[model samples]
Target: MSFEWPWQYNFPPFFTLQPNVDTRQKQLAAWCSLALSYCRHHKLYTLDIMEAQESPVFNHKNIDRKLSMEAILIVFEELRKKGNLEWLDKNKTRCLVMWRRPEEWGKLIYQWVSKNGMVNTVFTLYELANGDDTESEEFHGLEDWMLIRSLQALQMDGKAEVISMDDGKGVKFF
Candidate 1:
């Protein structure tokens, strides 16, 4: 799906950083919303800020706008502060975005598994994510890292167990 930026996004001045604190705050908030929406729309759970500097998100084709690294970092920093994203590396290079937190995702997973009588059944990570049995589920095609996080949330409640394997991974719901 394609995303259409709001009017402010097309405004030439919107590409430039505002000098005033109040204006900059508003711009930052707008940018945060845009980034969150884009990630959610694309099911994108991770973002590399440095990589984004050269991507279409930063480079607006029609307006010929691009964000400087300083601006990118500022926006990303704000996002981190708000808990919408968290740095994955010490250098703050990449982030795990939370359009939907692991806790919420865990609840969805539990519901899906219960509906399918998967509770107390052993399932390889591959089966849960890519098996034909799960193709119609919402959590199908979930990234392993994200799935592990979500299951970890469930694990806190004693609702799931994750077992490591030489080949892949396995999960048993309880």
Candidate 2:
């Protein structure tokens, strides 16, 4: 499915950083929503600023408009502040985007496990993400880091426990 761009994405002025405080704040909010939804739809867990600039979400080819580097940085910063993004480096070149928080992912996983009567079962991280049984699940193909985080969230809730083994990491649901 094609990603749906926000109304502001097609507006020329939206590409430029607004000088007015209120307008800029609203602009950043729109940008943050767009970025998160775009990443979620594409299953993009990480973003590099350089790569993102060329992406359709940040570059509106139809309108011949693109968000400037400064504006992109500002938007990313806003996302970070909202707890939906985490910078991966001090230079702020790369970041992890979380449209669905770990806790939310954890809840989905637990629900699936409960539905399948898989409680008290031990599953390798790979099995949970790439196993045939999970192929039809929303969490299928999830990145390793994100998967681990989701399990950790479950662990916090006492619904799951993460186990480390020689081969790799595993999880046991309660």
Q: Which candidate achieves the best lDDT against the true structure?
A: 2
Q: Against the hidden reference, what TM-scores do the models get?
A: 0.88, 0.97
lDDT tens digits by residue: candidate 1, 1-174: 588777777887777889999999999988888888877777788888877787666667689888788898888889888888888899888888887778888999899899878799988878877889878777787778888889889999999998888988888899
Model 2: worst 10 consecutive residues (lDDT sum): 1-10
Q: Kindly report which residue pairs in candidate 1 clash with one another.
A: none
**Candidate 1: C-alpha lDDT:** 0.84
Candidate 1 off by > 4 Å: none
lDDT of 2 at 47: 96
CA lDDT scores, all candidates in order:
0.84, 0.93
Question: lDDT by residue for model 2 over 1-174, one digit each (tens)?
Answer: 888878888899999999999998898888899999999999999999999999998899998999989889999999999899999999999999999999999999999999999999999999999999999999998899999999999999999999998889999999
